[model samples]
Target: MAALTVLALAVVAFFAYQANAAPDRPGAGGKPDPTPVEEIVPDKPSETDGADDENPALPPDSGDGVRVVYSLSAQRLWLVAEAPDGLGEEVLHTYPAHRSTVDPEPGAYQVTRRDEAIPGSDGVPIQHVVVFHSDDEGIVFGFSAAVDGSLPDPSAQARTGGIRQSPEDSPQLWEFAEVGTPVIVVP
Candidate 1:
């Protein structure tokens, strides 16, 4: 009887923590809206909107050139396209990504490979997988999304490495980010 009471209290505490930890979004488990409505990931470079202009994702000194900036803290992805003159750059698009509890170290990385529909670590059929960061063992963290746009929410104890995105946004990433493209993860 005492153990059951303790477990019930723990569950209540966990729910309270989740309500505070995650920023409220309409599609996220029915939480209250935390920010204004905007396009988190644009379709193209020229067609991008100014929804993410104020909150830049790339860190200063991240350098110029064609690269993708991913912020782990902000859960945002910004595609950068450099100017032909080699002096200026522009943000192609911005996206809100869902990452696993296992985070990759913030550093420069290059895309190593690409593949089609496959079973991700979370046991979901994922497509548009652009492999970038992998540990010495077998963990690989890359850009991918479930074939049906369903997201897998794992607990902290689970060491998942797949970076989930939307079905609508996955194609954009697949078309824009080719093999060997630069990817910089920021805090």
Candidate 2:
């Protein structure tokens, strides 16, 4: 019992040390730090280049310069990466996508989870799943593609929260999006 108590205290002390010892941040005293506001640098641009401009949605709508955009009204998705110099955004991929019969609200969401293959709520085999939103009823709004490239045809009574993509698009989405990646939905 004494050993267990010591171990617990050690764990608490480690956490407390971490909380108090952030390397680059201003100390608790809030003194002026060495790194000035003007000297701060923006994030470096992504390395990938734009995909073929032949896509109909070549010029994707800017969700305020965010990387990924899902248009509920158009049923389309655009995958963008920042240009190497931060001068602009490059359209990495754009394709026709399908949304749930009940669309999610227009807003920004982050990729909360991913799965390589899983049976959807409607019992369809899906792949490249990246979930971003969910409703109170446990219905999730996510991107997936039917493994066989079949367009989603949920029964009329089936209220699915799946936003499906083409089989071709699924792999790309899986590779690009990870946990915390921004997924902006627009009406």
Candidate 3:
């Protein structure tokens, strides 16, 4: 009886910690933080709708709402979310990545699974894996960061589905892309 009580308390504490650690998003399984985020307005607005050469804009065709956008051709990904005030969308972060040989067709998908750490198809230790799609051939497509800070060498191994990001960027992507979160891929 005492063991059961202690286990119940431990479970409650774990949930409480997770709720606080979760991102403050509508679909991220946590209550949105009531604090308003400060928006940094540029002194000189860009010529277009907030997009500039330095910070590439998301493809106009990408559907709205909070989503992780992946561009196959550019080998880049962006984490976008609705502005706190509900005015417009904001790009929280973007970074370049190394993709594997097999690519998922351009479209929308959702994060189906996540692993804190795992061995990638290339046998490299990886972390913060957020899997969104899998091909009919049994290849699982996901975003992850190599534990050793090295990208996959296409010529060194068989086709893999791990899209490798920098160690710094993987955690942010993992936090933003909870299961059921949308992932949009564009050409």
Candidate 4:
């Protein structure tokens, strides 16, 4: 009995030491030590970029908040985030992309999975895959970039749901679209 009691006390003491050794963080039963986050102000869009009705600031109806807005018609994608000040949202990056073979119907979806590198449906090496949706036919839809920086062949009869982005741009999208992050598809 004494041996068992000593063992129980040792276990409790070890946990107490671990708890004291843990780093202090905000909302972790410690005083909030808020860290200031410096916001990166991406170059503001040119006034004329949306001066024409052809391209009005962001898609006409992309919902506000931290989300990835994909426009099927414009063949563009925008990574948006809540401003550091919480005043509103900011478009961290935007770039042109090739449309996926199977479009997730115009609606809201969330990033479901991701792959750092894999062979795309077209048998080409792709990286930074950020998958968000899948169609009824079991085709998975996601954003990726060809390692060789090649865009999908417009004439290829391949049936793939991979939206190809520029090699320079795919990494940014992959970093921004984490699992459960909202993805808004706008027509």
Candidate 5:
């Protein structure tokens, strides 16, 4: 019985030693692995070749609310309105923006409830509770009904003048007169 006990202790000690042995690769699970530094990192350029020079000029009908224009071939959000002459169009505002990550399918506009926290100039908290998108820029521009009543006569000037960026930090226009409705964009 003493001899059997001694053999059992020897087997346990051998297994423990084997279990505690260092792996061939450091910081790995008992396996040989190549150094991380030896792995190649892929290179990605933001702009594609000839993307800029190939950009088409803004179309004649490109007047804004939520128009999508290309900057150096990168898609940009544009806010435009009719020119004062009652003849042509003019660009009002532009912003660089990232499209919605989850549902960015083209040509579909949906008004959804959003409750994002934003910081005010005085460090107060503001929330963006409403968001809308339209395939037509005009529709997006028309949704700013909250600001239409506060402007002076000759409302187009008011729409064009003193325009401020959206509190939501979005490229989309936040305020405008009712006359400035119907955001139009060229394809």
Candidate 6:
């Protein structure tokens, strides 16, 4: 009886080991799966030809002597002028600009005059004048005069003034200056 019990225990252990162990090779059922490995590498830079060299110049509506062109769509003001070679145009200046909220206006704005001195400095003021319009969309154009010194301190006292509009326009024009409308820069 003791021998029979020992033999039974050995048989159970062998089956348990076989069930838990992984097979070295695939059985007749299916092929074994391959082990997966991962690798990482940095990106490489690529060379490119100068495609921008062939780009066309700004439209004629910008003006023949247009030293600068400001596009509301691109939100960028670019200065276009004749290059030194006198063949193609060159970019003289590029600046980010805040567009006007008024709709349906067109044209390239210009700085015509300055109204008063700047807040703090005894420098020149800002004034704008409309020179050209790209479309009859009713968009106005103008420029603010350049400041000579640093900007005024905001915490100081505020100046009070009122703006008046002509009888031919609506109340909106009176409240705020529309886009393309020139502003007189004051020192």
lDDT of 4 by residue, 52-140 (tens): 33333678688989999999888888888887699987777787889745666789999999998999988899998999998888888
Better of 2 and 3 by TM-score: 3
Q: Which ten contiguous residues of candidate 2 have the minimum total lDDT? A: 36-45
Report the alpha-carbon TM-score of model 6 versus the true structure.
0.32
Worst 10 residues of 1 by lDDT: 32-41
List where candidate 6 sits over 4 angstroms from the true fold. 1-64, 108-111, 114-141, 145-187
Q: For every model shown, what is its TM-score relative to the native structure?
A: 0.67, 0.66, 0.73, 0.72, 0.31, 0.32
* Candidate 2: stretches off by over 4 Å: 1-61
Better of 4 and 5 by lDDT: 4
Instruction: Please estimate how well model 5 matches the true structure, expressed as its whole-model Cα lDDT.
Output: 0.34
Q: If the candidates were sorted by their lDDT against the true structure, best first, what order would they fall in? A: 3, 4, 1, 2, 6, 5
Give candidate 3's total backbone clashes. Answer: 0
Clashing pairs in 3: none
Q: Which ten residues in a row have the lowest lDDT in candidate 4?
A: 32-41
Error of 5 at 149 (Å): 29
TM-score of 1: 0.67
lDDT by residue for model 6 over 1-187, one digit each (tens)?
9999999999999998776564763442254332211111111222353113223234345554434455545444444445557886554433443333332234434433223323322122422222233235433333332233122232434321111111121111212223333322211
Give one digit per residue, the lDDT tens place, for model 3 in 1-187.
Answer: 9999999999999999888676763446543332222332222326777666556777778888989999998898888888778998878777788988778899999999999999999988999899999998889999999999999885665877889999877877877788999999999
Question: TM-score: which is higher, 1 or 2?
Answer: 1
- Clash tally, candidates in order: 0, 0, 0, 0, 4, 22
Q: Please write out the lDDT profile of model 2 over residues 82-182, one tens digit for every residue.
A: 66578975666677897656788888898999998999766789988999989897779999998877666645578888988987667777877888889
- Sorted on TM-score, best first, the list reads 3, 4, 1, 2, 6, 5
Residue 97 in model 4: lDDT? 85
Off by over 4 Å in 1: 1-57, 84-87
lDDT of 6 at 32: 30
